[model samples]
Every structure is written in C-alpha cells, then in structure tokens.
Target: MSTFGVIARREIRLALRNRGVVITALIFAVWFPVISALGIAAGAGGDAAAVAGAIATIILPVGVFMGYLFCADAFLREKRDGTIETLLCAPVSLRRLWEGKVAGVAVPAYLTTLLSAAVTIAAVSTLSGTPVAAEPLLFLHLAAVVPVWIAAAAGLIGAAQLALGMRENQILGFVFIFGLIFLIAGLQGVVSGISPVTEAVLAAVGLALLALARFIAGKVTKERIVRTIP
Candidate 1:
C-alpha cells in the first residue's frame, strides 16, 4: 500500500476504536439526516428538487463536523500519544504524513457524509411515499462537491490542530461545534432553491479551498507539529 493509504487505514481503525467518537458520529450521520430528511420532504410536500437540496444542506455541516472529529483522532491523538514525534524522527517527509492524515480524516468523514445523504434520501422518499430524486445539479453537489469540501475542511482543521497547542486545540473543538451550527443555519436558508449556478459556485469554492489546503499541508513541518504539543 502507499504511505497515504497505510496512514489512512491506520487512522480509520483508530477512529473506529473510539466508542465515544464512533457513537457520536454515527448518531449525527444517521439520525439527524433522517430527521432533516423527513422535515424537508414534508415541508417541500412532494417537490423532489427542493427536498434534495435541503437534504444536501443537512449533510454538509454534518460532514464537516465529522471530518473535524475524526481529524482530532488522527492529528491530535497522535500528538498526545507521542506517535507523531516518533514518526517525525523516521525517514518519512512531514508532507507525506500530513497528506496521509488529511486523507485519513477526509475519506471516512466523507463516507459518513455519504451515509447521511443516503439515509436522508431513503427517509425522504419513504415519507413522500414516492420515488424522490435530486436534480442533476443538486445531486452533483451532494456526491462530488460535498466530498471535496469535506476534505478541504478536514485538511485545514487537521493542519491547524497539528500546529496549535493543546489548549488551542481544545478551543478549536468548540469553534468547530459553533461553526457547524453557523453553517447549518445559514445553509438551510440558501439551499432551498439550489440551481446549477449554485452547484458550480460551490464546486469552484471547494476546489479552491482544497488546493489551498494542499499547499498549506506541504508547508507544515514536524517541527511545527511537535513544538505545539504540551
């Protein structure tokens, strides 16, 4: 396996082992999507497009939240356990380590987001008592754009956690929660009438953010991450 794949698999295993983290993420991924799906579908009252857009909004924040949460395990837990320092002493470049961590968090988190979307789709369809599907643009947003967005968001969070002190990481956890709330509230409003234009705009933004994150991840060094640990 490639270094990135190995690290990602390792982090996925570690993250799944955390009962609290797994439980929390599972609940958010499963329940909130179901609830939101029901609410939006019922509100949209048989409008498949609106319901789909609304479902996308519900999962978007959840994806970001889950990414940050999993990243805590990948980035901060490694630092706290001293594994990061040991790895820093190894022959691997810091950039590869960072890349692996980002993928580690992003992939699983995106999977959870996919689950959220799936659950939402099923629930909304069931509630509507008919086959409901997203518009092409909205579907693209959920399947393609959201995953990239989640990766970018996770990369940024993991990099920040690696570079910050424990105290700041604790603060960052709170920031993530509040940021999630903010995004959910704001997104709920704007996603109702999602158009191809909206999808294109968001996709562009996501790709741009992902590029910036990759650049920043390459710039981060072992010295920077290790120095931040308490």
Candidate 2:
C-alpha cells in the first residue's frame, strides 16, 4: 500500500474504535437531512424540485461541518494524546502525513453526508408519492461539490491543529464550532445565492479553499509541529 493509504487506513480504524465519533457522525448524517427535508417540504408548495434542492444545499454545509468535527478528533486529538510527536518523527514527509489525515477525515465525512442525502431524498419521495424529486443536479452537487469542501475544510483544520500550540488549538476549535453554528443559522439566506452563477462561484470558492489547504499543508514540517508540542 502507498504511504498515504496506510496512514489513512490507520486513522479510519481509530475513528471506528471511537464509538462516540461514529455515533455523532450517524446522528448528524441522519438528522440534518431529515430535518432539512421536512422544513423545506412543508413550505415547498408541492415543488419537489425545490425540496430536493434545499436538501442538497443543506447537505453541503453540514458535510463541511462534519469534516471539521472529525478533523478535531483525527488531528487535534493526537496532539492531546501525545501521539502526534511520534508520528511527526516517522519517515514520511509532513505533506504526505497531512494528505493522509485530510483524506481520512474527508472520506468518512463525505460518505456520511451522502448517506444523509440518500435518506432525505428517499423520505421525501415516499412522502410525496413521487419518484421525481430526486433531482439530478442536486445529486450532482452532493457527489461533486460537497466532497471538495469536505477535503478543503479537513485539510485546513488538521494543518492548523498540527502546527499550532495547545492554547491556540483550543481557541481555534471554539472558533470553528461557533463559526459553523453562525453559518447554519443563516443557511436559508446562503442557499438563495447558490444559483447558476453561484455554481461557478461555488466551484471557484472550492478551488480557492483547496489551494489554501495545500498551502497550509505544505507549511507543516517536523520542526514546526514538534516545537508546538507541550
């Protein structure tokens, strides 16, 4: 196996062992989609396409938030447990390590989001007695755009946690959690802007985030990470 795959597999195993992590993921994966579907369907005014679009929109942000939550456990928890130092000393380069961590978190988070999307679509289809609500564009959004954001968010969060001191990591964690909360609160307002023009905009934003993640990941070196260790 490639070094990246091996590292990612290890993190995945760790995530599975942490029952709390899996449970939290399941709750978010199921709850967010179901709730979003219900809320939009209630006011959808019989527009299945609109309900589908709303659920898709909700899933993207939720996926990004899930990535952050798991990245904390995947990356920051290692620092708390004193394992990060040992891992930093491993033969692999720091960039590879960051790739593994980001991929590890992004894969699971993205899958959970996909599960939520499926559930929401199925539930709405059943309720409305129409198989037509599963919009192709919405699914395309889930399959394409959401994963990019998940990877971007995970990469940035993991890099910061690995590079920063304990105190800064705590502050960052609070900032991220609260920042996501604020975003969720304004979700409806945000969704309105995701039209055709914003499809290109979303893609552009995703690319920018990926570029930033790569920059952050590139900055992670053994010397810097070890210096931050308490």
* Model 1 error, position 29 (Å): 1.6
Give all candidates' CA lDDT scores. Answer: 0.74, 0.74
Instruction: List where candidate 2 sits over 4 angstroms from the true fold.
Output: 130-133, 177-196
Residue 7's lDDT in candidate 1:
78
lDDT of 1 by residue, 170-207 (tens): 78866855664585466446644667766666667677
On the 0 to 100 scale, the lDDT of residue 84 in model 2 is 82
lDDT of 2 by residue, 65-144 (tens): 87887777787777778888788778998889888878888887888878877888887766665463446667667767
As for candidate 1, its clashing pairs are none
- Per-residue lDDT for 105 in model 1? 73
Error of 1 at 142 (Å): 2.5
